[model samples]
Target: MLMALSAPALAHPHSFIDMQTTLVMQQKNLLALKMVWTMDEITSADLLYDAGSAGAGSEIWKKLAAEVMARVMAQHYFTNVYRDGKPLRYMRLPSEYQLSRNGNKAVLEFVIPLAQPAPLAGKPIIFSTYDPSYFVDMTYKSDRALHLPAEATPACALSLFTPKPNASMQAYALSLDKADAPPEEMDLGQQFAQKVTLQCQ
Candidate 1:
């Protein structure tokens, strides 16, 4: 639900997000995650236009932010955490969240708390974030875009695993025009999302 725009002149991924993530640690447990998304200029422009004359932190701005947050919530925050092969749960609402501007771009920052902090020394922890429709391509610039709590490092580390969409998958994505959406059952975006694997030494 990120956008309902004009037919794309190109394939899927009409929008993009430059993301940075932090693994929040409490003692030896994974407590939460801090996510920062810097949106592309084109997407930022549309968002700003919707904001109108709303000043920073004003009621109007807050309302606008809430609307956007609602979209993210509806999509389950576009995030997932897993241990072994099973999914981990998150709090219904982020412990903290905000939508604002950074120069000509839009920035969203949020802290997603785990329902129950999982210990770092056990099963492998895999995490990923992506838009299911694959209308937007979310990426991390590099491993540098991922971080560990100062207290968690050395003992704990994260490795990014890039996605490799097969030729048919690529073609399917290319076939989607702006208005066309894949079936909900496809879970297309996750197929293209970069995954992070966490392990404590």
Candidate 2:
């Protein structure tokens, strides 16, 4: 463990989230992605503390969800989608969104509608989500984390690919402080995020 820590590659992630993604399909076509991000107890401590007095399904939860979602929107949802290496577009606002608590964790759920649904029966689609600066580590809990529409599963296959950052990239991520913002073009988050690929043929 010590040796691995001392290795040239280190990210020093400050916060962690267990993520799940659902591919919403219609007639074998991709429509939107339903995302759920569950923050660890320690990371959600402040939010939970603030909501300590608020009851479930109260306006407080709704208000907090909007506030957090606004930030997410400002960051392009901290997400990227592509088809055959070309970037895909998404609606500026999600059709549905909310924040809720489960047990000891805070959960964020949202659905990002595609500007135009793609035909999955024709090609593969790929996507990834992460914090560009590496301050927050976003990871899928497992292959099961990616839920597929039942109608499309028979003809589709899904896989999650966790990337291994090269030495230089790892060093750069580890050297940075939380206050620093990565350059937009670098797509620093992409280097460390787990990528999901969906194919239908």
Report the number of the highest-lDDT candidate.
Answer: 1
- What is the C-alpha local distance difference test score of each model? 0.85, 0.81
| TM-score for each predicted model, relative to the true structure | 0.91, 0.87
Q: In candidate 1, which residue pairs clash?
A: none
lDDT of 2 at 21: 92
**In model 1, what lDDT does residue 106 have?**
80
Q: Give the number of the best model, judged by TM-score.
A: 1
lDDT (10s digit) by residue, model 2, range 1-201: 111111122345667778999999887678999999898777676677777878777999988888778878887888899988899999999999998888778888999999998888666898989877666778997899999887777889999999888999888877776455578788787688999999898
| Poorly placed runs, candidate 1 (over 4 Å) | 4-9, 52-55
lDDT, candidate 1, 137-168, per-residue tens: 88998999999978787788789999888999
Name the weakest run of 10 consecutive residues (lDDT summed) in model 2.
1-10
